[model samples]
Target: MGAVRVVLVGGHESADGADLAPVVQQLPEAAVSTPGRSLLSQVRAALAGSDAPVVVLPMTWGRDPVMIAETARTLRWVAGGDAHGRVALSEPFGTTDHLIALLRTAATRTATRWPGSGLVVSAPRASPFDDAELHRVAHLVRVHGAGLEIGVACVGEPADLTLAVDRVRALRPGHVAVVPAGFATACPEADALADVDFVGPLMTTSAVLRVVRERTAGALHDLGHGHDGIAAGLDADHGHGYAHSHGPDGDHTHTHGDHAHAHAPHAPHPDPHATSHASALG
Candidate 1:
C-alpha cells in the first residue's frame, strides 16, 4: 500500500499556514501553499501526482468564500463528478465539536482575568462558522461561569464592539474578556478588536491546537479509504458517534457524537422577591 498524500489548503494568512504546516508535516506526502496563490491549482497538482488517496484539509477560520469554493471544486474533481471518491474532503477544522470545546476552553481561560463579569466578542466580519462558535462559547459562559454577566458582539454587525461594551458597562462588570474568534489577524476586523485588555487568538490555546491535530489525523485515516475506521476513530475520540443520511433533496445530514448541556450564566439573586432581568445573549 502507498502512503496517503494529504494536501493542506490554507488561507492567504502566513500565521495560519505556518500553524498548519507543522501539523501535517509528519505525513508521508504533504505540502502547503504560500500566502496569496491559486489554492485550487496547488491542490490539483498535489492530487495529480499522488497514487494514494488525496485529502484536502482547509486551514481556514471557515468564512473565506474562496476557500469554500476551492474545496468544493477539489471534492468534485476527486469524486469523479459522482457521489463518492477514493479521495475525500474532510470536514473543515472549524466545524468540529472538538474545536467548539476548545473555543469554550479558550474563552473560559481568558474570562478568568475579569473577576466580576465577562464578555465574549466575536469579530463582526467572522465567518458563519465563527459566529456559530461564538454562540457555543456564550452557552458555555452561562453554564461554567455562573454569576458573570455575558454579552456578544461583532465588529461590523448591528452589535459592534461599542454595543458590546455598552451592554457590559451597563452591568458594571469588573473584568472583560475579548475573544477573537478568528484563526489569523489577517482580517482587519479581528486585528482592530484584539487590542482590547482581555484578548486571545482564536486557536492559539493548547486545547484548540490538540483538537486540530486530532482532526487532521482523522482526516488522514479517512483518506486512507476506510469508512468504518474513520467513523470509529472519530466516535471514540470525541465520545460522539457520527451518522449520515440523505434528506428529501439528496442533501446530507450530519449528527454529532456528543450532547451539550445548556445552563444560565447567572445565579438566582439572594432576595427571592427581587426581580432579575439580565439576558445571556447566545
Candidate 2:
C-alpha cells in the first residue's frame, strides 16, 4: 500500500491556508501551495517523483472562480485532458462539516466563561460578497451556545468589529469571542480580533486543521474516500439560507459636520489590464 499524496492549494499569503496547515500535515503524505499559472507544472513534477495517489485540496475562503479554474486546469493536465481517475480535487475547506465543527468548538471555547450568555463574532475578509461560512459560524454558535448571541461581521463594512463591540456592550455579556473567519492572520479582519476578549484559542489554521483531519479520517472510512463525501455532506447539511444587506447606493447621502458627501459617478476604464484582472476572479 502506497501513501496518498495530497496537495493543499490556496492563496499562500491569505490566512485560510495557514489555518489549514495542521490538517494537511496530518495526512500520510501531503504537499500544499498557492495556485498559480505554473502550479500545474509544479504538481506534475512533484507527482512524477512520487508513486502515491494525488489528492488536491483547495483551502479557499469561499468558492472562488479563478482558483476553481486553476484546479480544473491542473486536473486536466494530470489526467492528460481527461480527469477520470488520475487525480481528485477535494472540495474547498470552508464548506466542510469539519469547518462547522471547528466553528462550534471555537464558540464553545470562547463562551465557556459565560456559560449562558456570550457573543460570538465572526469577522470575515473584506469583500462585498457575503461568505456562507460566516453564517455557518453564527449557526454553529447558536447551536453550541443556546442562549448566546451570535453576530456576523465583515471588515471595512457597517457590520464590522465596531458594530460587534456595540452589540456586546449593549447586551453586557460576560465575555466576547471574535473568531476570524478567514484563512490567514495577515488580513485586517483577522487582526481586528486582537483587542477582543476571547475565552479560548482564536480560530486559526491550527485549530481548523485538527477538525479537518478528524472529519477526513471519518469520511475516508465510511465512504471509501475522504475527499468526495465530506464536501457533499457539508453542502447538504448547510443550505444557503443566510441573507446579507448591500450598502447604500450612489444616491444615498452622508452628512459630516457642515458638509454633505455624495458618491462619485462611475468612471470609464482606460486599461485592459485593469479590466482583465477584475474579471479574472469571476
Candidate 3:
C-alpha cells in the first residue's frame, strides 16, 4: 500500500487567484486542483494518478451539499476500479475554526480602517444550510468582536441588503464595512450602498491555509482508509445529482471549528474570488 496523498480541490471559478497558490506551496506534499473544469473531473484526475490512497479536501466555505454530494458520486465512479480503493473526499474547508477567527480579523481591520464603523458581513445566499452558516458567523462576531455592531445580509436579493443597510446605518456608524462570510472581497450586492467599504475575501490567509492542512490531516485519519463503505452508503434517489441524503443515519461528513487565528491585511485584491456562499436573508 502506498502512502496516503492529500489533494485540495477548489471551485473552478478561483482558477487564477494567486493567494490560493500558497496552500499548495505551503504543503509541498499536497496537490491542489482548482475549478475551471468540473469538480468531478479534478477528483478523477487526482485519484487515477496517485499511487496511494487519496484524500480530497474541498477548499470551500460551508459544506456545500451539492458539491459534497457530487464528490461522493465522482469518487465512487473513479475509484470503483482496481485502484485498491484508495480515494476519499474530505468535508469542505469551511468547517475550520480558523475561519471565524479570520473573519474577526477581517472585520476588525475593516472597523479600524474606518474608525467606529459598524460591520455588515455579506454572503451570496445559496441554500438554507448556507444561511445557517452566515448566521453562525454573525454570532461569532457578536461574541468575540465586542464594541462593534454586526449585521448579516444575503446579497442575492435587493430587499435583504437594503434592510441590512438601514439597520446598520441606524447604529449611527461612521461607515459600514462589508466582509465576506466565506471568501469574498468586493460584494457588488453591497457595493451599491453608500459609505460601504469592501473587505478582502478569506481564501488566501495563512490561518485559512493552516486550517486546510489540519482538515486534510484529520480526513486522512478519520475517513480516508476503509471508508469507501461510508461513501458508497449514500442513497441513489437523492435529488440534485446527490449520491446520498443529508440524514444522520447515512450522512458521512465532518465539521470543524473552535480554534485561534492571527490577523492579516484586509485590503481587497482582484483575482478569481471564492465561489462558496452562505446566502439569503434572515
Per-candidate clashes come to 3, 5, 5
Better of 1 and 2 by TM-score: 2
lDDT of 3 by residue, 1-282 (tens): 126666666542133233357556676666666432454566556566667667776656543444544455555666666754566666566642445666778777875777788887776666665566567768877788746788888666777877887798898556887776665534676677788777767655566666766666666676545665325323211232223343444423322122223223442222222334333101
Compared to the true structure, candidate 1 yields what TM-score? Answer: 0.54
Cα lDDT over the full model 1: 0.49
Question: Residue by residue across 23-61, what tens digits does model 2's lDDT show?
Answer: 555654666666654557656765687654556656653
Estimate the TM-score for candidate 2: 0.55
* Per-residue alpha-carbon lDDT of candidate 1 for residues 1-282, written as tens digits (9 for 90 to 100): 145555566653224466454445454466665323455566556556655565555655433334544455445533554224455555555532333444456556654655565665455444554455456556665565545566676566543765686677678645565655555333344335433454555554344445545555676676555541222222221211132233344443234233332223332213311223222101
Q: In candidate 3, how many Å is residue 147 off?
A: 2.5
Cα error, residue 139 of model 3, in Å, equals 3.4
The parts of candidate 2 lying over 4 Å away from their true place are 11-16, 21-28, 36-38, 60-70, 81-84, 91-101, 115-117, 126-129, 136-140, 156-159, 182-195, 199-282
lDDT of each: 0.49, 0.49, 0.58
lDDT minimum window of 10 residues, candidate 3 = 233-242
The TM-score of predicted model 3 comes to 0.61
Residue 257 of model 3 has an lDDT of 23
